[model samples]
Target: MRYFFLLVLLGGLGWCPAQAQAPAARHTFALGPTDFLLDGKPLQMISGELHYPRIPREAWRARLKMAKAMGLNTIGTYVFWNVHEPQPGQYDFTGNNDVAAFVRMAQQEGLWVILRPSPYVCAEWEFGGYPYWLQNVPGLKVRSQEPQYVAAYKRYIEAVGKQLAPLQVGHGGPVLMVQVENEYGSYGSDKQYLALNKKLFEDAGFDGVLYTCDPVADVAKGHLPGLLPAVNGTDKPAEIRRLVRANHDGQGPYYVAEWYPAWFDWWGAPHHTVPAARYTPGLDSVLRAGMSINMYMFHGGTTRAFLNGANYKGDTSHYEPQVSSYDYDAPLDEAGNPTAKFRAFRAVIAKYRPAGAAPLPPVPAAKPSAALPALQLTQYASLLGHLPAPVASPTPLTFEQLKQAYGFVLYRATVPGGRSEVLKINDLRDYAVVLVNGRRVGTLDRRLRQDSLRLALPAGPVQLDILVENLGRINFGAYLLQNNKGITRRVLLGGREVTGWRMYGLPFAQAPTVAAGSPTPAAASGPVLRAATFTLAQPIDTYLDMRQWGKGVVWLNGHNLGRYWAIGPQQTLYVPAEWLRKGTNDIKVLELLRPEQTALRFLDHPILSELSGPQP
Candidate 1:
């Protein structure tokens, strides 16, 4: 027990255990054509995937402990590429973005590791998990095994491999398996690409078991030679067994890599809730039948800022972007509190065990919270008033050249040549709309691979608005490395590549941003709390609905609850019972883009608003 503390102390200083702790066998662990074995002993996995960047750094230990208490022996985590390598070679491993710390913490809790290092992990993460700098490369085709795409991918893998390979179980670390590219079958039938990923894993010296997971329907396409096959979500173990058999002539004990504990919700979609009562029976059957399963997310953490991704089903841009909170309606919420589902699943685990083998912990009281008066942000800054000096070079600049971060970057240029009724972006990523004299001219979307639009320029001062959001990075794949945000190249006006753009960095979250400079806010119509007052005689549990308002941030007794947007799906903000105080507490909200008299409600349920169909 003392040794565990020592390991954590060393791990805190970035120590990857490399000693005679357990001499790893030279032979790599492989799935044989029999019941699955770990060190030749039959093993049953109870794995959970938790993204490192989702939860704050301070919360990692508590969240992991909660998973451990929930009977999880393996903790699955995805290493986000963008967070690891924000710039080309600049890597940041501090704070909540620390993947190594998270893994070590999980291991210290005696849990096996399934490190999903997909450059293209599509977890409703921004842009599906690719770095934003990737778009700058010329002639790049993501997902497919394109040469340019492969080059960037190889570089990123090499960089990240050094951090992870040494941490494998072979080196006295707990990483048991490393997933190759996630769910490739759903994207394309590129067998070569799958093979390439497999080769890359071996070449990177990842000695642990390598596997791939796809939906049940695409099991064949997802599986690779010399690796285990895992189905994403399988309520029926028989189907998993059938797939294993289909892959290896009926080998027993199939694996469910992503057994769904809950589901993800987008802005306009119905809030998906998987009742504890409904999920327990099927999971019980899996355990009783002696199979292994990994909960996709035992605890669904928040996406926080603009990192939330959008859902796209088709080729042309019909996108459904996700909300900030990735609570996933999970058994463990973003804050790591166990739900009724957690108890039900724990009950199932207890049923399969000898009496008194493991006892459940008492439910934790919600953190105490205090209410502050409504926050009034006095200064206002119109983004247009403060634009950086234009890039005068005829040659266009990438999002990198602007030295800007995320949010709508407007690039306006006056036409120097002919007055053709058409102007188009050579490459318009996500969304764009051209405006002349503050009037709508044309619209374009990158989801449709479109930046082309007709403009009606009538000889005089003309304005163009190419508002593109860094829709977060793509979290999975070769495409992940090529995630250069914004319009990488130039806007074409009358078929001419337009340069000299006036860039604006409107990160939205980073407020009091570049305005014409801070100006006094327009007067409010009603009571704008001059010296606000509030009283809470006793502590209470409540869900602060942050929806009905526009984009803004909130605070409780001076504790920042993070930013909130009126975007659909997340109309409420969770104010934990633990973060509250018993006496006169306070609540403060600073809203932007909303009318003066905004209303705030304390709703039921942990998430924003319980879905009652779409909002009117």
Candidate 2:
């Protein structure tokens, strides 16, 4: 036994004795002058982005295994601040938010990890991954050096460090590199803010190599003096090397941080897709030039609930709210099954495997899918009937003022002896349904740059109500600064400011309860809650088809399945089998617009390609 222990210590034995087992092997990952060095040797990292919150916890391993089969050596992910700290100081790290477990899973699957724990990750997420409570902070400026912003950011980062700092490669874990603020230069050129971000990460105990990623044009502006610079949205091998070399000390450890194989979809647009042949050549060239690359999304699971974001190009005319399905036309489908693009990219990757490296794992088979018969939603409840007590206010309150994060808010006021005049809501964030005496007359949509509707008010003080929907906050560009939901400004009638409002906050943090077999009230012309129950012999992954339903949200077995609109593109919500039970399952729909048919079906596959002409 002693001889065997000696042999193990000297590395002469195949296995170590139980009592003589050494600590886990620690590694050094650094940026070399000409390459990324892993323990003093060059490593060509082939990584893919996958978010934990977007995928079900039970499906994380299966997705990671699929990534491995596609010949990925590294997995990149963003730590969404909003997902962890939904409230001001409250933090959650268990279940899908368990990022440490996710990193460990990558290591267990024989893959390295690159951590992008930026406070502002603009991956088309709501408010760029900022907690909605940030809007409530007095004199706080996001993505800036404001003292309050910095202090809050510090607390959040330190909390994250406690969860992941020990998982760095230096501590015998899989995380190799940590990213600073994501794509900072595209938004602003504040060197102090960038420096502050770097310092915060270092202070939080991320001792590994730190890096910054930006578009090729912003590389020089975003990168710090010591941190490595990476580029996104470009795959030209020569241009990548040039940008990195120009930004750094004239050397060549080039990395493409975000190579876009395809694009994302927004509401009212056709589903975006890129032919596999269009970008496969560029991918081949990047690999052939010995450059490292990370696909923007190997699989873009789903952007569940009100967490989806919108895009604004400095004006409301360009406001495009993103759809529920974030599939990204990636190598893997929304269900984590490999697509044709996966095979095409894998073939190119197989050609670049390091000499004598282990063979790629066999591609996993797709999970089985099941279909359900049409579910009739017989029971209904009116949203107005189930109102919580309102906050009496002289003027309309924004979502932040009411301490509400997402969903709808209702504003009620009485207009005395009104005439035929235009009803305008100043600074309407996204969408609003205007009602006069319990009748929905018209809607004000920010997407079309609309803020007013001509109304013929009845005589003798009619009750006026405006239900505003926070479609999503702008996730990118300068518009993000002014992304407060609800009525930011006062309502105007006939060019005069109207006051005296009662605001009802409807954050919908939990699914609203409606009594079973309740009759549809006579005044149920507005948003209604419809419910149905069905049984499944064996629950399999399926898509909830909402083509017949108008705009609203859905829930399956109490899980928020996400929003759906008749306005094309995303007609189905991907429901993971893990969220379903083998017995009876309850499904509910909150239809903002009345459904053409009060029934829904389950599809074995997703239907994200259909387009509707115009919304009602």
Candidate 3:
């Protein structure tokens, strides 16, 4: 009788019996009163979250296969809005941002998908996954019912729908559910805003089971009246049941949407790790209860480029910028290799596999890695020599006002100098290198709440240059709305506002050209553009050891590999093979702080736990 029903289901979805491995076809997935109903039968979704933008496009299949081997039946992913719509009215869904293709690949790997396409996904992403251009919109209030914000969000949702809506479950795709605004209750209790998001998704053609996920304390506030309320950060079967029953209709279908097996790391902090023994018991309980579950990060990939976000809990001293590697230390590491935790979790899940289910595949071997001999950066260029035309302003302009998103910004002005004075830059977003007459004088760091520096000026007019780097935008808390990079306010000298500034937006949209020359003197300070070239017999996965380097950003073959700091925690950047070539490969480094050595190394393994002094 079960075989007969399976045949009928396949026939209804237009799948032929011979095509056993065909892509997912049209099907019904609905929230039941006591359980999630898949074609009128209860279904437990053993899922894991992996963002498309985080993983390289070429390795999406391998990552999905890894998830399956870990005994996961589904793949959960967040469609980063900023990744798709980088600029207002401008959209990109190609290459690494190809979310639809990722979903299709998941289906091809025999896995269902849970699509979280929220405009505000607090996934440690820049500006909470909001496009940086949104800040330039006048009278716009994000995460609210403001008219302009709503219009812009609707347009973005429509754009995403055009790419992903057709891949929903009912449309013969793998997406079983689409999420509402992520963790909105913790941010705000605006039911109207949640309703607007729901309507927007519907208008965008998301016609599957829609759900809202939040912490246990926020399920009631974030959940819509008719949608499923999923809990995060907890795996206790009783708590999960109680939260779902209380927010829902006092029934069942309890879902732990975000089960954290480990945590993420931030700059200047130790790498976070959770023991498998800590959470496997909770997993067993949830599985034994027949409740559905989705691991927050089954495979936490890298937060490449300037996309990493920070945490500012309304206090300057509390600001913590996230590191480039988003390797959440889950079952799968950043390089897509299974860890000991993977085997432990798989053992727990194996016992819960449904009857007649296919055996889990053997874990795939780790990808090959290569270690290169130490090489010196042979070319160097001073940032002062490569200045573009500056925009004159009476005062320093914020990155938003300058129409810039990421990278460094230079503020220069001529100040009368005769005596030493205290230099203060109000609202310095992140880090700055203060230089007088093209010579490094001092530095100010926002992480340490150091905004004022005592500088000794020469006996004549001196060129004052303040090079500011936008570390990462605040991704969580009330400070998220106040995120403005570079120098947001006035520059004061000895308790007075200094005016007449020439602002240069160094977005570094492309790798700057470094003329062939010997390396800059190690004694030199401030920002320097360094370059090196090498040839590879074959491209293989590797980690660029930035331990000897100071605070800076690196680019390989014109692709930005993100930032690294001598501050430790994350000592290396994962260099994917997909971004490398077999011939000559060019590499560039924009070192913000002077390094003792001008050399680089490639390691076979990542150095994530090493610690060093915060200063260079």
How close is every model to the real structure, measured as TM-score?
0.77, 0.95, 0.95
Candidate 2 lDDT, 357-402, residue by residue in tens = 9899999999988777888887788777788999999999999899
Relative to the true structure, how large is the alpha-carbon lDDT of every model? 0.66, 0.88, 0.88
Clashing residue pairs, backbone N/CA/C < 3 A, model 2: none
Q: What is the lDDT of residue 276 in candidate 1?
A: 88
- Displacement of residue 614 (Cα, Å) in model 1 is 9.1
Deviating ranges (above 4 Å) for candidate 2: 1-23, 417-419, 521-523
Q: What's the CA error at residue 326 for candidate 3, in Å?
A: 0.8
Question: What's the CA RMSD of model 1 in angstroms?
Answer: 7.0
Worst 10 residues of 2 by lDDT: 13-22
Distance from true location, Cα of 173 in model 1, Å: 1.7
Backbone clashes in each candidate structure, one number apiece? 42, 0, 0
lDDT score, candidate 1, position 563: 51
**What does candidate 3's lDDT look like per residue over 1-616, in tens digits?**
9999989988899886678666545788888887888878888999999998888888999999999999999989888888888777889999999998999899889999999889899899999899888888877889999999999999999999999999988889889899999988788888888988999999999978899999988888888878889999988888888888887788768888899999998888899998999989999999999998999899999998899999887653567899999899999999999999999999999999999988999999989898976778879888887899999999899999988988889999999999899999888988899999988887888988888999899988989999998988988778767888999888999998999999998998788889887567756665788888899899999999998888888999988888899887999999999889998899999887773457889899999998788631
Clashes of 1: 42
